[model samples]
Target: MTKLQAEVRSNSVAKGKDAMVTEDELDNLAYLKAVVKETLRLHMPAPLLVPHLSMADCDIEGYTIPSGTRTIINAWALARDPSYWENAEEFMPERFMDGGSAAAIDYKGSDFLLLPFGTGRRICPGITFAISTIEIMLANLVYLFNWELPVELAEKGIDMTESFGVTVHRAEKLLLVPIVPQD
Candidate 1:
């Protein structure tokens, strides 16, 4: 969580916002939201969405999907689709904000373009809890501290590499330097 906060702060600064993040500022931080969305997209904790069994035969995208077919949604692939994102291979959060109204798109099941937490009935049961926790924690941390990459690692840019499992995690552990805010 601390690492994530650091990354968010770094991103905010890169976009020319001051290093500090406040509660009121959260609503206007479209770039931060975009960063979060891009992070979730590129590193989906669950690379494969929950499995489901089709009740009846169905054809989707011209494929003959038979009844009782067990299927899994490849959320990882969907998130990286070039049709939905430009420079899909790059970790560019600005793409989400380049268009009008970055916040117009919904992260819920409504938007097919981005589904880090899956979609429809099988969507993550903990969606609300996860989102609320992240927002509150990020707000408080940014409100309280200024962060930097550790001296030893500062020369090396953030390693965005991933190691996949039940949940995705950084290939290498994240180490950061934190400074408490002065009143």
Candidate 2:
């Protein structure tokens, strides 16, 4: 979070603002976008996407699938696949920074390597709406205050264990203290 705040502050200063994140600024904030991307990659809201059915019998690797087979694509596994990502278990937003190899990949469903929103015709219809809203909300939250876990909690570290079912989320509530900047 400190890195993200510093990045935003530097951008704002470059644009002649002391420290502010406007909707316009959010549009071009490469680091912010990377953060969001990394978040999605690490913790996809829906780890298991809608099940897809095979139209016809097919051979995948050495396994043969009969026609009309129900297949559930594990998007979470794909995003964290070691073959496609470096330090896959770690949260490194820099992996998606502009000009980086993963920068060209997106959640729009086209990139199988990172399909948080699925892909093809069955892709989430609300992708644009959701992404825009997420960017705005996250930008505002990150820009408005500095946040940290309570000292005791910080020492223990955050519990990143996920409770996977309908959707994937932290196993425990994340308690944090938001320190608002004084005017």
The top-ranked prediction according to lDDT is 2
TM-score of 1: 0.75
lDDT of 2 by residue, 1-183 (tens): 878877776665344325456667776678888888899998999988888998899999989999999999999999999988988989888888766768788777778989998988889999888887888787767777788899989888888899978688899998999988663
Candidate 1 wrongly placed segments (more than 4 Å): 1-28, 97-103, 181-183
Model 2, clash count? 0
Badly placed stretches (over 4 Å) of model 2 are 13-20
Q: What is the lDDT for 28 in model 2?
A: 66
**Candidate 2: residue pairs that collide:** none
